[model samples]
Target: MSKVRIYTIAKELGIDNAEMLSILDDLGVSYKSVSSTIEEDTVELIKGIIAEGGSRAAQSGAGASTEAEAAQTSQTQTPQPQTQVQPEQVAQAPATAAPAADSGMTAEELAELAALEAEEAAEQAATAARAELPHRAPVVTIMGHVDHGKTSLLDYIRSSKVAAKEAGGITQHVGAFEAQTSRGKVVFIDTPGHEAFTTIRARGANVADIAIIVIAADDSLMPQTREAIAHAQAAGVPMLVAINKVDLPQADPERVKADLTTINLVPEDYGGDVITVPVSARTGEGVEDLLEYISLTAELEDLRADPKGKFGGVIIESRVDKQAGVLATVMVQEGTLKVGDFLVVGENYGKVKAMTDSAGKRIKDAGPSTPVQILGFSEAPSSGELVASASNEHEARELVAQRQEQRRDEEEARKKPRLSLDDILGPLSEAHTVNLILRADTQGSLEAIQGILAKKETDDVKLNVMLAGIGAPTEGDVLLASTADATILCFSVVPSGAVKKAAENKEIDLKSYRIIYEMIDEVDRLIKGNLEPVYEEQYLGRAEVRMVIRHPKTGNIAGSYVTDGLFKRGAKARVTRGKEVVFEGTVAGLKRFKDDVREVRQGLECGINLDWDEVQEGDVIEASEMVEVEQ
Candidate 1:
């Protein structure tokens, strides 16, 4: 008889290869991989037993054996003299059917079939361990560009002043909250809009079941907005668009809708699947509609969890609460969490002493999709740490200790001696290149720096950007840079204190700057082996325009009084109105009491001519001289 491969039979039964192999193991059946074949009669016996246990169904829709075959086989092997098994029962228990037909089967086949029966009995006893958990609130992540009303919309929905609480109205950390709308309660994860928090935003997108991409009606789609869309897409979650700030006079919902098409997120009104709703985070217009859509989405997803089984969740934020000790905000993804449950998160272990919802209301239990603050962790877990409930305190402790040991080992491995610049450049004398890890505050800045560095390559030396990312330089980046013998360059992103300390410990070269052009210029200087400062600007004098005097031959000249230093005739002048510079040119002409003069002293009145027009009264003219200096 032909033999059937385990994988081919498993595929027919709609069972995973690994699961089938485990089942075969429990039955004492011989097999190597899933491709290992078994006797045809043994395969028929196992399938009949699986069908009898109701663990699986026949691949062909017609029961175990067809009507004609079952009748013929049953009549031949099963005699009415001793005991007769019904045909319906035989059909239901197909594995036993083969045995009744072949009463003289081998002992090995009999033993394996008996083993499967015992295993199915054991499984039936342990089935339905937990009651079915009801559908939970949808966890929605809010993401957008800075000043695009993300926090404002969250504030209005939660009815809290979170925006006001943020320093400079910029969210510095990820915030999780639960809000009760008329439809039902919805959990919201507010991610920082700045590009420096890309990791945090990605984490938010990862944990959320739904994403709300906030777009200001007046502000076009920005780089961060596109990044948010990309993050949401990469996470494979459903998304809703919130067109905020509709109350503003310049708010253009239609224009925003049109711009969204560029990113393939066409509005529902435009025959697309994406739901776009206009809302005013300031005055609460159309806010209820957004919540309704979220509720509908949750219903469509039919989100559920096992309430009585193992509890698992993701850590949203963790900090050492001065009064409460280690407090962590967690979003429950499965099962139910209660006070006094043994929990393990990352390298920490503890019993849940207390739990509270976003409103600070003490709760004894938290279900799936609920964000709660729990106390009693042995150590503060990092953000994005996954949480799991253990069977007992001892088990949790053991897991925590094991994880801590693993982390220590990994850290020690990373501390291995790193390569130095001399180690690389010293070996190559003729041709040399500087490997650099570049980090910037925004995606655009990172791309610009990478482009500039790539274009600046030369025959003698080349500037290679080993890694470029939109975030503050992290310790991992420092380690990579150290291993690669690369210097780290940061533009408009300040490294955290911990990262800075790590870099110092590693003795890595890290250069940070706020201006993009300055960083580019320094890299240019480094590439050309020109370390000396060629020229530096010095403040010459400042003057306030008292009157604007226009001439046919010369451009707009300002009748001004020297405020500080001495105004030189050939010094560069910058005209500033308020905080913005209006014009930058050289001081073409200077006159003191109608006498052509090269310089005018402070506290004196003079007439200054500039190359540009629009010299308004009360505008301040700043003069500076370029003086060549040594390195």
Candidate 2:
């Protein structure tokens, strides 16, 4: 190699090129001074120096031998311009060269030359790997409704047991877990069963490779179930249905299958191949079958990872661990990860100090299909961030700095002033529009709300229900609404305190209502002033207090007239003392005197009895109405 190439190699090896000159000095290699341009003879001499184990004396011997070879070769034949030499002539020249001086190079020199070449090659490999590494994971989030056993199914899958869990078990932070099976491993993110996942869903991350939808066999297909299916379909992932609680006495698998058919999940029982596993998590039944199904599906899809490259993965979740410091559960999609490897995850970079598998076992390294908790990140990485490993700390820091600059530039771009509607569309254009994100407690409620709002669509002021789902309002949903400059309409589902605060800070309108029609009516009114708000209160049937025929002194029966709404026969009934429950008890009887009744409707009176002895005049008796209002 020439002196310039040697300097390049030295710099790459983190050695000062000045030191290379010093080594040449001790080698006694006679050469034009440092300021002179590198000659072909000098290049050969340097190669000889490297071949002789890079020692000063050995380099001098190799340089002397190279000079001797050049002298003898020049006498025998004129030195041709190597750059223009034909391949055949170059090959022949090497074969006919004077061997004595060339062979004088020592084993140490040869080894040193090979070492430098290997180092340069390794650096090139690392640079290529870094360029190829992907920075994010395929975030897979679960969605469904309350009481539909969504959490139960996830808990069963995560814990490998379902009996020891509580009702509505997932009550707090949205957790992420990695499940390994025969086919491969998958990271399951248990997002809050709220509209937040929908927003994440809309972002196109937090969607699954396959959506495992849980629906109760006994309950059949519910509105929430349909909404979950819709969201999954919208996300465009293959879906499998887990018909849960099959151990229940009233569980009807056929009914659920029939119900699912309407929603396009035609079950095998009905002659379609859409896999529906009848599972009873409480009994640990069909869990193995479910795993097998997942494996088979993955095989068919050919899910694969290029494990030969630099490490790249997605951050399933991240949190500050008391002992481990900032920990992140990352699904390694490619390459190997070891302790002390510098990693750049999103805007953060760190030297990995330790790693643990999903089971919390200490591991020295992790590869593809492995889900491991990584320690030593500079900061907590956001969920869904893509992580990559660098060859050194400096490179890692540079990569992070570049990413930060790119993000800053993006933010600045978004802040750049934009032309107004009048500038784009002209002041003569007469058009108005409203965008809304609709969320509800149940699928039925969402459908009802959507149906009501769909009626208000028009040419000028269009009511765009940008996104709708069945769940509580989540921070992601709030963020999405803020980004879209849209209003949120929540029906029945409560908004979390954090989401409420975010909404307030963002100045986004979050309207919540218990009645479906009222929600629709208000949306209609906002979207179009011509559409008067039509409120309809729903009466969900009624129940009565029968046999109040046994009043003693006052000769007054204390039975209830359930003009509307449902009344559980023995549920606590309160006399409304200005919205306060004064009288609450079991209904002693429900009847029209000579007969017993399960429920009483509006404009109907039923005889009932109270356990209390007190009866007074001017006391108004009103039955609670199960009303849900909609436009």
TM-score of 1: 0.47
Q: Which stretches of candidate 2 lie over 4 Å from their true place?
A: 1-143, 146-207, 220-231, 258-274, 419-436, 439-631
Q: How well is each residue in 86-192 modelled by candidate 1, as lDDT tens digits?
A: 43444455454245544454344555566677798778765533213566778887888778988888878776422233335432232577777765778887554
Q: Report the Cα lDDT for residue 118, model 2.
A: 72
lDDT of 1: 0.75
Question: Model 1: runs farther than 4 Å from truth?
Answer: 1-133, 160-174, 190-205, 405-631
The stretch of ten residues in a row with the least summed lDDT in candidate 1 is 194-203
Give the whole-model CA lDDT for all candidates, comma-separated. Answer: 0.75, 0.64
Model 2 scores a TM of: 0.48
Model 2 residue 425 CA deviation (Å) reads 9.3
Candidate 2: tens digits of C-alpha lDDT, residues 1-631: 4444444444444544455566667866543322223455765565666656557777789899999999999967975543333333333443332332344534444445556777999999987865464432233445555686777777777776222223455322225556655434555666534354455443334435667778787887765666566556545666778888899999998898887786556775576657788888677688777765665455434455556677776666678867757877776767888889988877778888888765555789877656678778868977666778899989988998999999999878779957774554434435566778788888788787777676778766677666677788767667666646678899888898898998998789998998777887787677654332344433244433433456565344655556565544443444434444456554554566568766556667765444555433223334343332443
